[model samples]
Target: MRAKDVTGIIGEEIAAEYLSRQGHEILERRWRGARGELDLITRDGAQLVAVEVKTRRGSGYGHPFEAITGPKLARLHRLLLEYCAAVHRLHERRRVDVVAVVLSGTSEAHAAEHLIRGVEHLKDVS
Candidate 1:
């Protein structure tokens, strides 16, 4: 696999581990729907969190969290709803979050950030 793809796999694993450590039960990893993909879907207390994982080798283009735009957030929002409907988990509260992972040249992630409830219904995302 390509280095970037490998990096993503590692990022998702790290993201999942972080979520689990925070007391979230992973409902899905790399979940896909008609709209697009959600990197990590988990139940956080009584809410369903749709997470986007951004991973990069160092801070080349800036931190991973800087990657998610409004359109991407909207896409994830739709996919999250679709996921809830398909799985009959509609009653759960929902939110969007971004998880960033920075893999250093030393073959270890230098940092990871998890932003909770980071998205909202905004028109400026486009």
Candidate 2:
């Protein structure tokens, strides 16, 4: 795999591990298609969460969470709609989360922070 692809995989692994440690049951990883890509899908308590993972090399580029701008969130929102329809009927209990993963090339170095219950539905998409 390419450098970025490898980094992305590592990032996802970190995110999954963190979620598990936080009492979340991972349901899926990289739930994606032509519409867009969702990094992780997990359950927190009684609610299902759709997560977007953003991995970065360092702080030079900017904060990983800041990369998740409004347009990106909108796409994630639509993808969440697809996931909800395919997996379950209820929508009120679902939420969107952002996982910011910081990667290091050195061994024994990795970090991930899951932004729980982040992102809200837009008032108007049109």
Candidate 3:
């Protein structure tokens, strides 16, 4: 697969691990709907979290969280509702999260070495 795609996959994996460590149960990864995609869907207690993962080689453009604009969040919200409806699921609460991963290099070694520097989990974004 392409380097960016690979990075994204790694990012999602890392995000899943991070969430698990934080006591959340991973419900899905790369969950999709007609509106958009959710990088990770997790259950934290009674809440359902819809996560968006952003992976980049550097922050030249901006922090990964900055990439999620108002419109993108709106779409994510719609997609989250669609997901719930599709699965006939309900939660006491719901939220949107963003996981940003930045790697120093494009290689796997660099990704593993510099993960701590690049990984940031922003919760309850919406």
Q: Candidates' lDDT values, in order? A: 0.72, 0.69, 0.81
Query: Per-residue lDDT of 1-126 in model 1, one digit per residue for the tens?
Result: 565676788778877887788798998988878778788888888888887888766666776667787777788888888999999989888888777766656343322332232211211122
Q: How far is 63's C-alpha from truth in model 3 (Å)?
A: 1.0
lDDT per residue for candidate 3 within 1-126, as digits (tens), equals 666677788878888998899999999988878877888999999888898988777767678888999999988888888888888886447888888887675465444455445679888886
Number of the top candidate by TM-score?
3
Note each model's CA RMSD in angstroms.
6.2, 6.4, 2.2
lDDT of 1 at 75: 86
For model 2, where is the 10-residue window of minimal lDDT? 117-126
Q: Is 2 or 3 the stronger prediction by lDDT?
A: 3
The pairs that clash in candidate 3 are none
TM-score of 2: 0.77
Ranking by TM-score: 3, 1, 2
Clashing pairs in 2: none
Which digits, one per residue and each the tens of the lDDT, describe model 2 over residues 1-126?
466676677777877888888888999898975697788888888877787777767556776777878898888878877887777646647778887776543322332332232212221221
